[model samples]
Target chain A: MLKKRIIPCLDVKNGRVVKGTNFVDIRDAGDPVDLAKHYDKAGADELVFLDITASHEKRDTMIEVVRQTARDVYIPFTVGGGIKSIDDMRAILRAGADKVSINTPAILNKELITKGAEIFGSQCIVVAIDAKAKGDGSYEAYINGGRVNTGIDVFSWAKEVEKLGAGEILLTSMDRDGTKDGYDLELTRQVSELVGIPVIASGGVGSLEHLYEGLVKGKASAALAASIFHYGTYSVAEAKRFLIDKGVKVRW
Target chain B: MIGIIDYGRGNMSSVEAALKKSGYKFVNTDDIGILATCDGYILPGVGAFKDGMEDLAKRGLDAFLKEVAKTDKPVLGICLGMQLLFDYGEEHGGAKGLGLIKGQVKKLTTSFKIPHMGWNSLELKRESSLLSGIVSGDDFYFVHSFKVVPDDDSVVVATCEYGEEIVAVVECGKIFGAQFHPEKSSDKGLKIINNFGKLVERC
Candidate 1:
């Protein structure tokens, strides 16, 4: 069976990770390259970089970060945030990113998904959705890191993105993000069951059991977490062992 | 030098970077003449099989690859490049492939999911120069919706199960292919690229 993936997302601002890591394993744990190397060694299936710094001037620095990370870390890492145009996607990809995740631009101009898939192939385009539960048994898609509401239905939007040529969907639940409670299983399962493509469950991953829930209960293809792994709450190898111990197949 | 064929698809730079990182000299070019001179050829691609095949034919690379196959001097394909090594593919309408390996690329009919993306463990079926020094069940990165089913299972170097067995690596004579992107698969994956480099060196 296809192994479930555990990806550690690094939030970057101005070519540097926004938060510093206090890991004893990594010499410079806060450094994106060093942190990525640590995760690679820890058995992370993949890594994702979100460019919180969307400034045009900072683009070069972001590219440099990607290049350096690519040189040091061999596992594929995705670059998200601030990627607006195909040229941006091409630049980062050339700089050595295996895939590019589009959230804001994909919602603003849905054609970007189809066009990007047409030009670079669907495998390279990952559509990320930040959704917050409506309390009315529905969820609304958000952009700008769950700040702005797009008023789009999450289920319908996921299907649209899949139809628009997106190879995978990164579904983040704003309701559970940073809460450390667990994934929004209802939302993840709801959206995942609707899309034919793979869905990566993100936000509020606080424990190994939570990741398993994201997979077994939420029906996510992969589970993505941030702080827990970043701050050394648990190593990726530990997460894999935990998952496999519970019958979830994970690549070690 | 290993010749990396530019079929107007696939991340040529990633493969180039992987080659450079592994301390191998390679030329990324589409010129059939240049490709023929190299000791080995890598058909790298990323796109629908129909478009890739059409582009290869348009650029006269189809004939070039066939000619190189006859020489049997280590020809390898990565991901979509690997799928294109077969007889035909059923993506975005059925399309003909290079026929270097007898098979058809069809959509993965697993109830699990499509695009079978991310990391998966290799279940080695047999030994091959491409997977040299790699253990039987090492992990490698994979991102694809369609998989190649070789007519002759003997060519299957390894298999990765995703609801069903997926052809992970294939080798027959000097021709080779990997459904996973070895370039993006980290150390073991790069070791596979290094193995190919050794194959080129042997050639």
Candidate 2:
């Protein structure tokens, strides 16, 4: 069976991992490369390094961090945040990143997705969507750290992006970010049903059960969490073991 | 020195890195002279069958490789490199392969996934120098949509279960092929490569 993936996302700022409490009150976790290697040893199926820093100095440092991590870790790794151009994608990929995730830039220029897919294979491109539920019971697209609302329907954007040649969708619910209440199942199901590519559910994985529920009920191919994993609340190996015991096929 | 055939596919760096880490002398090359002088050869690839075969043919390394294989120099193929040892591959319509192994590479019909990408336990089917340090149930990383169904079952060294008994490693005389990347698979992967290194050393 296609094994379910458990991923640890490291939010990198100024070449260091900055873990926040519910996406606020950020603190230094550790060196990004060291943390990535630790997770890779802990049997993380994949790792995502999001460069959250806006400074030029930090951007280059993050790229170097990714390069170092790729040298040590053999498993697949995805780098995201501020990937503005095809050159940026190439730089990250050439640095040994298997895949590049784009959010704000992809939204600003929809053709960027197609252009990226053309240069590098579609399998190397991941489109991450941050969706938040509206009062009218519709989900809206948010960009730039969930500060800017695109007002685009989540399902529509997902389908369009898939058509634009995205190999996978990294769907995160802003409303559920760091809540640990559970994954926003409705958003996951809606987007997953609309796209043919793999959907990685993100934003609100609290426990092993949440991981199971996200994959089983939410129909996500993989699940991503930040705080729980970064804070050592749940180790990836134990979570995978729990899921495997519950009949979820996970790669140990 | 072991020569890892570079046909512009993935797994080249990983193989080289693993070999270096294992304390083995190796070179990644497409040069025919280097391959001819090497103690043994390691063919590593990751992509479609037709594309891989085209790469070998374009470099004129295919004929050179066949000639080398005939000399009993011990050549190992990893992942797509393993599939290329067969007579044919069903990927991209159909394509001709190296014909070293009497088999046809066909797309996997397992219910697991299209691209079986992850670590899976191997079931050793037979004993060989390639299986020297590696044991049964040892997990290795695999990422492919097609698998080789060897015409000669005796050549199979190991098999793994996904939905069916898929060939994981095959050893026939001097030619050994592993459908998994031993380099990217950590310790077990390195062990498989190390065993190949030993085989070259013995030769």
Candidate 3:
């Protein structure tokens, strides 16, 4: 049986971790590589660095961060946000990051998904979708940090990406984000069932229960959280122990 | 020293880093001469079996690896690299493998999931040095769509369940293959790599 994965996402800005991290033992909490190494020690299954860098000139910093992390960390890690082209994907993967998640670019040029899959293999190409439920019970895909709505149906776009050779889907509920509420179970379960590829349930994950809910109730293959892990709410090992006690198979 | 084969396919960085952390000296090389110089070889890959085989052949590594497989020196294949050790595979219209191991790589026919991604615990079939210091049911990270079907069940030293008994580790007289990415599998994974390193050192 495949074990459910717990991924800690780090938001990067100008080569530094943007979100406030509360790991006291870490000398430089803002350092993505150090925090990544810290997370690996804490037993994180994988790590994701969402580069929210404003300037393109500073983008190389993220690559450097990825290079250092890959050199130091043994577990798999992913670099997302601001990745727009095949060349960008190449630089990141070449830096030793196991996978790269694309959102805006995937929505803008769906062909990138197919091309990345063809070039780098589908296992490395992850299509992340930011979804917001509409009043009519339909969810709409958003781009630009959920600021601009693409007006594309989340479900249909997910199916399209899978057809285009995306290996996994990182589904984030815009409505649930930052609420500390929980994952959009209906959104995650429906999408997980809708596609054959693994679905990583992201967004509103406030507690271990939420993570468990996302894995069991939402039917997501993996659960991703940032604040809960960063703010010292729960260690990855603790979360795994909790999941294990609840009978959810997770890597210790 | 171990030679990490670079065949123009798959993830080589993680293997290099893992070996380095395992305190083993290694070189990333495609040169058959350099690979021959190494005490052991680690074939790490993450891609299609057909592509992997084609890459090895294009680089003339297919023959070189086949030659190495006959020797006492260890040749550890990871993920797609492991599949390439098999005689044949059903991936991408079917393609011939390195034929080092008596097995065929076939698509996993399980209702659980395709690409059986993430961590899964191993079930020990028998005692082997590859799993030294590792407990039964120790979790190892795996990410693949196909599984190898060994011609002889005795070749299989370890198996993991994902709706069925999926081959995890196989050791046939020094030619070892791990369907999981031991490098990406964290501590226990590093231990396995170190065990292989120790085997190579012994040689």
**lDDT tens readout by residue for model 1, A214-245:** 99999998899888887789988888888889
What docking grade does candidate 2 earn? acceptable
TM-score of each: 0.94, 0.85, 0.96
Which candidate number would show the highest DockQ if scored against the true structure? Answer: 3
Candidate 3 runs further than 4 Å off: A20-29, A54-57
Instruction: Give the Cα-based TM-score of candidate 3 against the true structure.
Output: 0.96
- Ranked by lDDT from best down, the candidates are 3, 1, 2
A1-252, model 3: which lDDT tens digit per residue? 678999998988777776532212222237788899998888999888988653255677888999999888888888898888999999899989999999999999999999999888898999999999997889999987777899999999999999998989999998887678999999999999999999999988889999999999999999999888887899888899999999998887
When 2 and 3 are scored with DockQ, the better candidate is 3
Ranking by TM-score: 3, 1, 2
Which candidate, 1 or 3, would have the higher lDDT against the true structure? 3
What TM-score does candidate 1 get on C-alpha atoms?
0.94
Give the top-scoring candidate (TM-score).
3
Ranking the candidates on DockQ from highest down gives 3, 1, 2
**Residue A95 CA displacement from its true place in model 3, Å:** 0.4
Residue-by-residue lDDT tens digits, candidate 2, A1-252:
346778888989888898654557788878888888788788887788888764244467877887788677766778998889998888887776767999999999999899887666566789999999996768999998888999999888999998897878899889888788889998898787777677899987788899998988898888898878888898888898899899987776
- Once superposed on the true structure, which residue ranges of model 1 sit more than 4 Å away at CA? A19-29, A55-57
